[model samples]
Target: MTTSATTETRTAAREEAEGHLRALVGSDDAVLRDDQWSAIEALAVDARRALVVQRTGWGKSAVYFVATLLLRSHGAGPTVIVSPLLALMRNQIAAAERAGIRAVTINSTNIEQWQPINDAINAGEVDVLLVSPERLNNPGFRDEVMPRLAATCGLLVVDEAHCISDWGHDFRPDYRRIRTLLDTLPTGIPVLATTATANARVTDDVAEQLGRDVLVLRGSLDRESLRLGVVRLKTAEMRLAWLADHLAEQPGSGIVYCLTVAATQEVAAYLRDRGHEVAAYSGQTDTTERQALEQALVDGRVKALIATSALGMGFDASLGFVINLGAPQSPVAYYQQVGRAGRGTDDATVVLLPQLEDRDIWAYFASLAFPPEQLVRQTLEVLGDAPGAMSTVALETYVELSRNRLETLLKVLDVDGAVRRVQGGWVATGQPWSYDAERYARVAEARQREQDAMLAYLDSTECRMRFLREQLDDPEAVDCGRCDNCGGLTLSTTVSDAAVAEAGEALSRPGVAIEPRKLWPTALANLGLDLKGKIATGPAAGRAIARLTDLGHGQALRALFRAGAEDGPVPDPLKSALLTVMKDWSRDWDERPVAIVGVESSTRPQLVGDLATGLSRVMQIPIVGRFAIVDPSIEPGRGAANSAQRVAAVQRRYDLMADVPAGPVLLVDDLVVSGWTLTVAGVALREAGASAVLPLTLGTQT
Candidate 1:
């Protein structure tokens, strides 16, 4: 063919691609930026791996969607996107459909739809498929469906790719499964890794995983719309008061980020009490509720969604403001969350309210890091010598770790080839695996450094944006000339006395209901406990004077209950709080407790006795008697073990000491965790003919 004809054909193709991109964005005037085009060219034309690190609003989604359409036109197979969030998948699917590219997702919430989705993909009817990183570990998906998709995928895209790096603030173990996927991918298939927040270290880690000669496209990280500032509050109450006072003034709908799910609920309740339209979004939120909350934020129906990091990453709202109740431990996490705001506006407010507890929270999270070599080896030995594949639940019976911590360790082991997750459960891979002590130590060190950087950011007099950029290792870290420090703008730090008082009162108004354990824990039979199905007889729903993390009474309770805390009589103030709790409980009581029973404590016998005595005196109920230790040698503190072990331990430790009361009785304890203690005690009491057992405690450790 003539050179002129070939050139004309190529030019026409480019114009058509641009037109498709414009349609995808729903803007006739929409045009790709140079870097966006470069990413597209590298993915569709060059068929090479590429990483796009740009600000949130830089149209990263557009690049991938446009590339999907172009690749589909050339008859490349469906684009396989490993997205981190369900909200993001929904948004991407909607946007892809707008561009006439078919997209579907397979996630935990959409299990019933998986078969049809797989069928559609197999039939070449899907142009793009979005899957969560966790899905890569699913037995059926990994063993059956993923391989077929991987072999023919048009392009592989990792959204929020920073999560793949251990150095990332939001490192997810499931993301490591992507390395297996990458190793098995067909040659000549292009890959795209996109994120708005990855420092130089994370970038290097992710890029190395992508492949040799991967293209790295990083844009300036500055967001002119975000006006960054920090408001250091003296206490949680003051910080909450600040939010309640100033939330209404923020432009458009926004998010209020909290460090914990409990904190999210607390903040949301306080805000609602202060008359703000808000909802709490966190992992604990039901899937349907999460969808509703996401929609509420998008439609601007709510002022804000008080949330944990669960509400982050892939939530696409042109939020006008982002307020953090407590600072994230890492600057990258803070940057990613704040990036959610000001994406579609010229100006947006981003404020951080750093509290003293943020460091404690950070430390708590750090403690959940990769397990020690002993634990890792123990898990491996268990799997290696197992009779067969063991489900994570059953495996936990052999390991004395929380389900969360155990699952995390298992995922890490799965990546390291120490074990394999299959249809039945996990089996030892029989591959030699060495625990990387130095690597884990480095990760811990990196986390501490990030915490240090976050603290520095809170105290820095330099440009706030510049400080963040430097933390992310952005070369273009010049002062943004917009933050409070760079622009000489200081937000009002004063919180009203009335507001603080009200907040203090709200936080201190203790007594969160301790919902009774309705069912016996699963797999008790395996533990030789002879327990099966739900427990027919158990303690009635209970109440705690305060959670160990409560804002008001929580601090005192935590201090009193902390390890090494001296055992003593229940103090006068706590007695008053206990009285107040009962008073509150009386309002909703269906039956007056005729007696009080104390759970015997080996360490805090004095405290437990005092609390029970105090309640007995104030409520004028008979003292039924305290539970006696069946085995005095049995240690008092609950061990970190699975439910079966816990239940077995509780069963062997305590027994009813005296005749049961006929009427409802209040079963008092120093603290409640796992609910096994109360369960066994209540069962024994019921068997001994108590009408009902009402559990009340000074603190709960949920």
Candidate 2:
């Protein structure tokens, strides 16, 4: 790559890199492919930016690791790798060790190792250092650690580079921080960005962000080793039964991906009950627990790890299959998840069990898209006027965005130079920032197109793998002859009726605990509310008959909650389920409610009132009081949007509460979306001298 290098010099460097690659792969015959060597030369020798977009198993890691060693031998400093997943970091550390490269990672899981790792970086003893993109925004890292590293870094790598583009299926807000990182690195430092799932659009976006003269190397995105198929089922019970009856026949330990955390637990429990060894895993899984479960999958100690997207990206194992319990929201995401399998293997199965509720799940995620321009303007205005930096919680009181959405918005604003994150919290940079409504609308439209593509994948009769490749804009897309439609081997969907019945029982038997709010929301005084800090007395932890996301009862709940549904007494089946839930309540007789009360519902007053009446008649409890609307003009929809807004609406609505409930009370409501309504009502009841309040709701919207 160096114009002045002699032939001997280039050949020697090539040999050295190949030697390292052989050792990393544990095969003496393992040599770098031509494209891999090209990427390596562009970085290690030419000292230029390169973007590598290749299919999984194409040795992208080998390109960077080999380049790191080559650069080190030439007296360069350690390579800083911005990776996206903890599982990937773990796999990378082990892979680096095999290559005799001393790699260390700084992530959420290894907080205790940070000091030593930083020390090693200063000592020049570390060859490669791994970190998450989110870490780049951490005040300590951005202000203290990054400037030093950028000044000394030899090579910088951004793994899963597709995330840097909003067009990508996984366009994480944190990943946008990498653009700032690139701007800070020394001018001549070699930079490499890589991903296996990027389409032409994502590839161009990433390369443009990397800067001018970046060497773009995109190969065919096809995996011949993966045998893709779809198992269509009419109901959740049928799908669960299918998994129970056929999962044991899969070749080896693999992953079972679900869309939500609750579904992960339910499906995992059902499979375990059916005598398969499995574990439930999600982002909520503790750090230690995640490590153990990841190891179990790698070691084949468990048949499968039921998981959400948290377990995805860079988890390396000799996986023989990947089964999606339900379709992902997009084909690109589906390809990324299935890429976890069939690495270095001749054959691996990828199956999708498309659920009837997939579109509904897609709609739920769509609701969390970028907020309206008014909300964004509100957040910016709040930050601009604040005396000092405001924490995300404080911002939530001033703006209607939820915590997660607010945090994500802050990151985007930070990347756009409208705001900056400091040690304590966030401060506006006073830069004129224009809301790019057209850009956001384009992104939203892209996401919808991806969802439609996924739906097409589900119904396609051609090669399933080809459909995925086409979705990714792979020019080599063709029938692979290895899919179910192309005559690939597949499992049967003949589940026993008994298995279906068992799954039905598991799905329908529902009761999720509703943990009571302990402390009131912050900044209550700003809203002219007296509440602050911990409450002395409030509602006991309560229960819901079912979650609206429940696989068995969710469809029915959707029908009941859907706009324009008739409002009347609780349906007989739900009434029966409610009584059964009461019978199965964990509380003792002494903790039972002595009286019944109905919380006024503007949307479905009949549903809430009938619940209270039915409970009183069946249990013979006294009907003491009902909460009435004190301010009917209050916008109740705000109660479901943000904490401060919700508390205001709820407090205003329930100011006129009925008196004379002297004992534990059963407060009935149609649904609990945010719990602010229930919280305000319970606190008011306690202040009015009720002994205790317990909430019973028809559904939880989680």
Candidate 3:
């Protein structure tokens, strides 16, 4: 055929595919909104592969659906969609079925499933065929399916295309070989890749790896309806209590993300005991059960779902909330999880409950980079023959690490191209043996550098939104105005003087003694044996009795210790310091206040419950006699005045806690950024009631 004739044929074929898409969707304009339509039109006009980078909930699927329909309508062969997850393929197939489109998927969930689908395509009956990337790299499947369908193949669509980029959060080694597939396809067959989230680096990587002339389309990342909040807890018990209370109040469709399968099971059980209709999904669960549970969630049989990171990638639900039970190791993960909630324009909540342990977990993983050559080599050798893929089972046979550790290591390898993924196994992409130690060392060093950068981003003290914007290379960035810190409602501040004075006055009552410990032995015991040991070793033996004499408690204890004093004199300074510390604490009640902000009103009860559970942590030993305060001033609203209200409200709440003798107050806020509101609230509490306040924010911004 002449060049012009071939061009005409290709144009005609694309137009036909567009028509088929409209017909399948049952409306000419069913798939694309105005902006989305513009994007599709641009893609169709340009024959090269293009990258569609949109925010979550922006209908990225519609772009490819429209393109497929256009091509199929023109008598093009079946459209092949390479997906990263079986759940995602099922989701798309389900949606297509609902729209009266003929779509089938080939994944492990269905045995011999692609056979019938392949037959249909050979007979020119199928319009769209969705398969996992692993399947695309399967020589047997490729040999059977591609040639039969090649004559009619219209467009190749790679969903969650970010997986093709090393910079992406969920990099898959198998995705790298997708470029080989593109190379094998007819030269004129255009490719289209779509992702909900990707930074500039990821976008570039996707284009490079796909080996296609690329066009880029990105939508706004801002989800104005989402209210972000962070909570910092001192212990695991406190985190559970927080989860229970938060789920209780929200009482809607949501997902609680845990870092491990064990954690997921534990949290789900805890929530269930608290009367939540909870479901759990983890890698440990059978695929069938997981599918049934996912369907139950979609059907509204479950009110809340607790899961590990395995659940979030391509799972879609219009949930009212998404709660992170622990801080994710990376912001990319954070954004992806939070994006699951607030799919609609209606206001929704994304709550992060960060504990010290969460940070430790991240730090631990960050420290695991730059593995020994043996470890890397073993990882590659295990991935042998697969060339770029490995099923969960296949991976287990090779790696000795726990599932979690192994997954992390595979993620690292996939990004580094030391190993690639294929159907049911991984393939060594670089030198399989230690043939080039120097080169391998250089590659390992580069990988470590990137990993370090990711860790630094996690540990940053800058605004989370600003940091993300910089990472994404978004030039027109502004303060998100919604995260814990940017909203100006942190609770980490000192209590006011007046509140502390009031607390002191209450404690100084004639009958009140400083040895409040004697008043509640059960409470003291519940403080844990660690505290008990600390007190016994440090102060309880010699100085505790004498210290009570300086405060009114000392006088009361002195009467009881008169015989001891007769036996042996106790030093005066230790006794005096105890009383002074108590008085100082009481005096600073208003000055140092703990502020707590709920991600949403629904989470207020959770904030309260977690605080109550963590009270011991705040009041024991190093933190004893400190104030425990909650500030509920930050609300989701626009404007500087609203921001000021958020700050003032936190201050006022701390001032209230400063007057209470619950212990030295710890400011509890959901999120922290610049620490300005926390500083203001601390100053206010000092001026109001607290002697001193320490700030405990859940997730630090940056």
Candidate 4:
């Protein structure tokens, strides 16, 4: 075709795209931007693969929604959108309705709707169908639903496309499944991938995976309406006090990001007590509650939602402010979160309240990177030797990694073709697999560099927006004259004495309940241990002074457990905190403990002994007996050890060397990590004539 003819054709497509945009946004005045039309033309006109790298609120969704309408109007099949989060799926479905598009979703939350939804798609009654990456690998979906959908898919949309690139901040294993499905797609079917957080490297990585001739439309990552600032507070108490004193003065309802779930609960509870209308959200929250909390924020019914990373991405709200209780590990991730605010509003506040302990949290997360090659081999060997497919619970008896980590590794291996996932569980394939140690090392080093960049962001004397954009490799990064460093306005650091006192009191209020284990880990007999089914002699629910990830006594507890720290008796603060736990705990207890028994600790013996002695003195209970280590070599100290391994490590390694009192035995230890050691010891004590066992510890891991 001639250039003139091609230009005429593109002009007509742009005019048609504008009409679709108006319907999508419910506005007669709405029109498509030049780049938005280009993306739509690539899919609707040329039928090509394209990766769009743009900032938040940049109409990335408009391109797809419009493209879907054009394709469906042209007698194409339904558009399949592989979304990553529930919040994103909900947001997409709502947008589809505005465009008069019939949208349906298949996710874990709405399992009952799957069959009906698939049936509607078959009847050509649905315009768009959304499914999460994790759902793509489901047996029913992968074998029955996904294949049929992919074969006739009109357009494939990968939302949050950065997830497929390991270089991206939020890379996920389940996303790798998309790469496999992409290879099987029918020719001439268009694919569109969109994200706001990918850097230059990540952009290239995703483009290469899409196809060789993929079109790349990249844009600036700078957010003009967001005024960025960093407020370096010395402690959690000071940060909380500052927020309490200044929350109402900030912009409209916003989100307060916390690094840990325990921090979210603590901060949300403290603010609520101070009369702030806030809610806590994390992965631990149920699906129903998460939806309600999200709606509350969107409707402006609450002041803010104290949340972890679970709410960091895909949430749509024109928030007035985005406050971080602590700094994120990387600047890329930080930008994605703060981008949620100031999208629709003309001006918004984005502040970071950094503390000294943030690096410790970063280190903790860094430790959960991909496991070593040796462990991967062991997992494969176990699957190979099994007579049938093995579930994650059964595999835990042979693998040392934690359940979450193990499951993620298995998914990655499945994608690598080293294992096959069937109806029941997983079976090893005879295919040879090689571990990419260099790739793992490179990713780790890249993460460290990202951490260093984030630290630079905290103390830099340049424009905050420019600093962030440059980190994302955005060429348009320049002095925006809109952040704290660019002479823009910022929130005050002044905290009142009363507010500080209130915050301090809240932090000092301690005690996290430790629920006892109800069922034994499956397949313990495979490891030479006689344990399975329900745990009949398990200890009753207990209380800890705090969680290691807490915002209160946790700081001190973390220091006490740090490497090379001195082994001493309980600190005055923790001891006093323990007294508070005792007072509050007694109100609900049926009877007080008659004796205290210390669980043998191979790492922190002195800490365990002192904890036991102090609790015994405070309760006026005698120190009747202690467990002795019979097999000193049976050390279960790896932070990565799973439940079954922990139980086996303590099964017969310790013996009750002391006579017990008649009543309940208060089991004391330095920490309760997996709670397996306490369970083993409590079972032994119960068999030795103790009526009941109550487990207590200084700190519990969440």
Candidate 4 lDDT by residue in tens digits, 1-702: 112338777787677778989988888998887888878888888888999999999999999999998888778999999998899899989989988999999999898888899889989999999999998788888999988998988999999999998889999999989999999898888999999999999999999999746989999887889999988778778999999998888888899999999999999999999899999999999999999999999999999999998996778888999999998999999999998899879999999999777998999999889999999999999999999999998899899999989998999999999998888899999799999999999999999999999999999999999999999999999998988899996668899999899999999998889888888888889889888888898788988999988888999989988888888888888888988988898887788889988987777888889898888777788988888788887764642378888787777577887688778889888887888878888888898888888888889877
- Candidates in order have lDDT scores of 0.85, 0.87, 0.57, 0.89
* Top-lDDT structure, candidate number: 4
- Residues 50-128 of candidate 2 have per-residue lDDT tens digits of 9999998888999999999999989999999999998899999999998899999988777899899999999999999
Q: lDDT per residue, candidate 1, 31-99, as tens digits?
A: 777788878877877788999999888889988888888888888999999999988988888888988
In candidate 2, what residue range of length 10 has the lowest lDDT sum? 586-595
**What is the per-residue lDDT of model 3 for residues 187-288, given as tens digits with 9 covering 90 to 100?**
667688888667787888787876746767766676665666666655455556666555655535778887656467656765676677998888888998
Off by over 4 Å in 2: 1-3, 586-589
- Model 4 residue runs over 4 Å out of place are 1-8, 638-640
lDDT of 4: 0.89
TM-score of each: 0.95, 0.98, 0.59, 0.98
